[model samples]
Target: MRRTTFIESYGATCKNWTWSWSFVNKTQRFVIFGAWQEDSHHIAGRHLILDEHWATRIPKGSTKARRQPGYPQAIEHLSRVAEEGYALFTFPIWQASVGKTGAGRDPSSIGRFEPRLTPKTLVHEGGMWWAQDLSVVALHSEPDVQDDLADVGAPELGRDEGHSKPTGPGHYFPRDRKVREDVLKKSGEKCERKGCSEQLRYKSFLDVHHILGIAKSDRVTNCVALCPNCHRDAHYSPNKDALNKQLHAYARKRPSN
Candidate 1:
């Protein structure tokens, strides 16, 4: 099975995007293919793929700007094919290019605006400055495109089916100790129920509860710390305010130590 990948760049009203494909084999750099938008309505570039004994370059001329074959199309196609088990790798290319006027004015002339420069040359003239902003897409193909398709497709199925699970508590907890610690500290080691603050003193007494349940994992701000008593009351109490009253009662009983 061979591996394949697709990539593309889109041109904004004020900027063009470029795409390039490159890889290394035994210390040799090989550029497979590249594409870019030179203007608002055209994409042009070339790519070279090296075989075991030879190299093949595919020259892409300007094509009419169409919504179908642009970045959106490549993304959709690559995603769909990858879901079926294809091995594809798509990445962006950041290149250097000259900063020229949208109207293709002379590089040397500073009309109303001062010179805007990029890592790439706007004019290949001896002293012209260049700046970096160009990007491109590189697509790779193996001996058999079908093999590549299967490689990407299998993993995509697992992702789409929701079979992936996080190994830790909060999404932020596993990655950031500071955030977790800050949340625990700010919660005063107690349940956030309006009246249940008295029951919390140690970490063991508190549980971080998601107000809307686990199904809404994306809702991070909806979580709060709660002591076991308050946690249970929040769920089982006939009236939600009962937990608030309990917290208030707990506060009243505590000595002002």
Candidate 2:
């Protein structure tokens, strides 16, 4: 543990305050202990600062803010202070909102101290990171519950069972650009029709026809590249099964070279 100071600025008064002194180093075991202040301005934009050597345990929703070149210089300064070896603690204070009452205890009652553990609690309960934390905060203010009750005309949940009509020109997959590049490369840019040595120049004139005609059966062994003329002949020819057998026999007899 070591002592390192962090300064936070107050927008209203244009004055800065020395916020916390924390242990920041390469050590593995660390705990961030702090109290929440109801009226302190620094709470809204608060974060735990760490040097490169120290790993940070940021609660969800906190991100590393953008920094200037001098950020590394500031880290170096903190590392030097940490070399002295002292236990570190951080106290985060939230700046009260506009026209809000300032930080002080009420005159008639004793103040109770509580841990700010809602964010950590929701995370451990296997909830979605953003939505859970938001739900907790909304519940704290009670407005979310009130709003849900006030919305009487909201749509019923999960009742839609109607079938959707087909729209025009739906694609099973993309036909343009790079779709045929790998297919041509695998089939050697030549039509798979036997004894047909015509090189395929335009992929648009070619189609990847499945041997089984089932969309799910798209394995390489079950497909072949065909020119439009050969493709139409395969489907419309009077003896398609006999013609396919002849084509397969011809393709087997020809050498790949």
Candidate 3:
């Protein structure tokens, strides 16, 4: 399990806190004590910024941003230091577990930190930065907070069932369970797109689509059942004008119950 040590860093008095690492390295086992820069402060120039993707520091400079130690470190209860705002929390980590969000600092630009700028959530620890509290969090907490990290076009986990992921509101139809079932039933458990024989496998593969468009139609008749592939094209394909007409005609052909 990971451990957290809360620290207080103020501009004046508590600027320089101390840390020591003792272990047998490839060179030798030795102990060194020095003033460590907590959270908002970096080792030198590296700025610690949080990647919204997986809420981590995939951009190489992250290790230097979070200032995490390799081994477990603790703070006593009585040793609590008081400050007006902003507390730095330090912890030990398994370096391999660090998350990668995107193609970090292109080419040869790593380890360099600008002296003037201050870091936000990440601080360099063991020569890398780690993500702390996300900037867009507090209102969106924990699991929902993780949702923000996933890509807008990412696939759902339960493909055969209800879509549990957030689809960009204006682009995709809402995950209304009743509407989903109604559309799937109308299609006779098959994809409504012409030439597509794909049967409804789950709530996800067979998406309940809006023939008029997700952003415009609220009427149930405007919706239809489409396979994932056709559904994607219906919204993103450059030839949507023709495809929308086809889907609208297909859905309207069914007699009203």
Candidate 4:
């Protein structure tokens, strides 16, 4: 589909004729951005599974001209996606010469992008918002053409040093693998839930569930062993948060030794 059709399909209107971003559909609660494949704007590095799309590095929100008219709303939609765990869409765009319109960047393809909360991708620095780390999983064309790198025109963007693995959010702390192993082993190969009789023939049958998610420390006191049924309930149940709180309370009461 063409750029206008794609954006309009998502209940957004396109304003700029040459090139633009921020096709935000407030009602739909989603944002579709035009991602540039230019080397200066994107990093499709070999080391990272996700590609990084960056906004032009300019001071924002301080001066009237510095704030791109569409930026504030677009940023709002993107932030909502991140906080609410919604997907963001990106259409691959690049400069091309057309017979009547002359030369300009246009969206030729589309892709799915995952919103991340890492400082590099989403941040408010010096009282202004910065979008330097938009992450693209893969790009798809009309005929189901999937390009992992999204480096059709820019080859140098995949240089080894250009990209690295994505980091967690500020509150995210890495958990220790050894702590998980110890917690699982200490559970006696059985579900730790109170009054539950599930038993595991092998250690792998029990999952070492993190009571407060992996973002918190992976100490034995923060982890619990559960059978598949209990594990699923802890994650997918309607009262998952309540179940998590119960599990954490149990973990805290049990002896760490």
Which predicted model would earn the best TM-score? Answer: 4
lDDT: which is higher, 1 or 3?
Answer: 3
- For candidate 3, the TM-score is 0.35
Give each model a TM-score.
0.25, 0.28, 0.35, 0.38
lDDT of 1 by residue, 133-245 (tens): 12211121111111111112233234222223332221111212333344346666765666446655543345554343322221224345566555555555566455535
| Candidate 3 structure quality by residue, lDDT tens digits, 124-233 | 23333332333322222222111111111334432333334433221211134566567667788888888996995653456666665332333457776777677667
Stretches of model 3 off by over 4 angstroms after superposition: 1-176
Clashing pairs in 4: none
User: How badly does each model clash, as a count of residue pairs?
Assistant: 43, 4, 23, 0
Misplaced by over 4 Å in model 2 are: 1-169, 174-182, 246-257
* Candidate 3 displacement at residue 59 in angstroms: 55
Model 2 poorest ten-residue lDDT run: 122-131
| Candidate 4 off by > 4 Å | 1-175
Q: Candidate 2 — what's its lDDT? A: 0.33
Tens digits of per-residue lDDT for model 2, 99-211 = 34322212111133222322211110111110022322222322111111111112232112112322332111222223234445666777787776467665344555444
lDDT of 2 at 27: 45
RMSD of 2: 23.9
**lDDT (10s digit) by residue, model 4, range 1-257:** 46566667667654563334556666765556655555654433211111112222233233322223444445555555443333455555554444422122223222333232122232222222223343332121110111111212233444222224433331111235576567767777778887784887653556677665432334678778887567767766788778878888888877655
Local accuracy by lDDT, each model: 0.29, 0.33, 0.37, 0.47
